[model samples]
Target: MTDLIAELDPTQWYRDGRGPRYKQLHRHIRGLVSSGDLAAEDQLPSEREIADRAQISRVTVRKAIAELVADGLIEQRHGAGSFVRASSNRFEQSLSSLVSFTENLQARGITSASRVLLKGLFRPTPTEAMVLGLSPHHQVARINRLRSGDGVPMALEYSSLPEDVLPRPDKIDLSLYELLRARGTAPTRAIQRVIAVNATAPVADLLDLAEGAAVLQIERTAYLASGRPIEFTSGIYRSDIYDFVSELRLD
Candidate 1:
């Protein structure tokens, strides 16, 4: 802890243009945690120690530490000062790419697996028929899966495809895109909408999150090269561990 205090050089705590003193300190500590300079479970110096080392008011130190705790980057224990929070398996996915969950995880060297919850060929529901351009008599192949990365439950997915596009739903043990590509019907593009939702009891159980925890609900329609819709998928993702990033540029 003494060494940790020494590393928080007082001179580095304030910058000419950086907003406030508290925010500056917050960013500094967050950087240290992100860079692994401060490992999980490592104790942070007491507020007085930090104040003395940085030559700042204890109020400033307290405000900075409070913000860190709110960010889920640290925790305060009763009678035990504060500590860096244990790292969770957080993942960032790019919105610019059209990729399957399996492919996304594989690119990061994370093992991906899916547990099939439901799979069958059935008459299309009204919404499914409208979305897939299927007639009432047409059948849709449906698959529901619990997707995991390195054995940690990540997302719950339910996908509906034209029956002809996915005749053997049982054959999909991993990447749906891989199977579609092999059949020469892989989606070339997609329209996706993401929204925040509270976890239901069933969703909470599957993702191992508390009931009412915030999660991301994604609805996607994937199209083949010829502009035909091939798949309609709805997924529930644990927001605590998943981040979707999109780059913006001024035209």
Candidate 2:
């Protein structure tokens, strides 16, 4: 770990325009964790040791460590210093990209699979009708799937599409996006909202989490290039195992 810390070039920190020293340090350490150089439960160097070695004040180290702890990447134990939080099950996902669960896991070299919980044409729920721009008489293909990575259940997803768009759920095999593309009704963009909720018994069981455990509830509507709503989806993800990230630019 010391060698890993020493490997960070101080000059690289300055290249970001000498911002808050603590912020720089925070980014540095977080980068190490994100890059897999620091595994979960690995102890961080002592504040004084890090300060002395990096030629920074202990105050800076403390501030940076505090931010890390707040971000759930680090945990502090009274009398035991700090340690990296377990992230083997955790995945950091980008909000800016319109990607499927399969694509997301594939990028990280993890096998992705799904178990179909429910599928077929069905009457639209009130909310689904409103979101999918469906008429009262229109039916929808509702697909409920339990998505997994490396054979470990990760999320429960419920998706509804106008029957006109996806007339048959039997056509889908691995990825919904792939099937949509094959049908030439693929979504080019999406709008999503995320909230924290306690897992219900069924959802918890599907994700292998305890009942009432914190989970991330995501609601998404995907659109075609012509701005037509094609799919509306809701998913519950294990909070202990996932991180959603959105990057911003000042300019």
Candidate 3:
């Protein structure tokens, strides 16, 4: 681990430059882990050791380690220091594009499948009613699916659509977006918000994670070309098996 840290290019550590030193270290260490230099379950050097070698303060090392822990890249033990996390079913997703789970997995050459947990018309929650623009008297199709990639459970999706837009729940299966396209109500754009949440017991069981594990929660409202909202969904993805990435460019 010490040798691997030393192997990182010195030019990349701009401790006195624009960004914070800990961020620089975080990026460098993350690269090492992603590149296989630091294999899964490998113990990282102590904070003091890293600080002494890198000529930085222990504070910086601690901050960088905290960020990596939150990202699910490293797990810190009470007395054993930090170890690289092992995830055989990890996936990275781009936030720049609006695509269904099936489409995303297809692009990665992974098989996507869904186990329908619930599918039927149901009364909308207050939040769902507002997001889907449905009347209080109307019902919506509430569909819960356990999404899998390469036969491993990856996420639990709960989606709602105004009954007037979808009507028939029996015909919907696999890809909801595909079915929407056939109905001429496919979403061309969407507004989404993502946040980190602790997994509940039931959600943990469905996603094969331990209770209280970290999960990424995404709330999305999808709209058609006419600007009419077509779908509202809440998805809980296992952080250990998924990553959301976005690229930015300066003009």
- Model 1: what TM-score? 0.68
- TM per prediction: 0.68, 0.66, 0.66
Candidate 1 stretches greater than 4 Å from native: 1-89
Q: Model 2, 1-251: lDDT tens per residue?
A: 44655744465342344357787677667656755678888999899887877678899889989988976789999999999988544699998888899999999999999999999999898999999999888999999999998877789999999999999997788899988888899999999999989877577557754345578999999999999999999999876668999999999
Number of clashes recorded per candidate? 0, 0, 0
Q: Which ten residues in a row have the lowest lDDT in candidate 2?
A: 9-18
Q: Tell me how candidate 1 scores on lDDT.
A: 0.85
Global lDDT of each candidate: 0.85, 0.82, 0.80
Model 3 pairs in collision: none
The 10 consecutive residues of candidate 3 with the worst lDDT sum are: 9-18
Cα lDDT tens digits, model 1, 85-117, are: 997447898877888899999999989999999
Best by TM-score: 1
**The best candidate in terms of lDDT:** 1
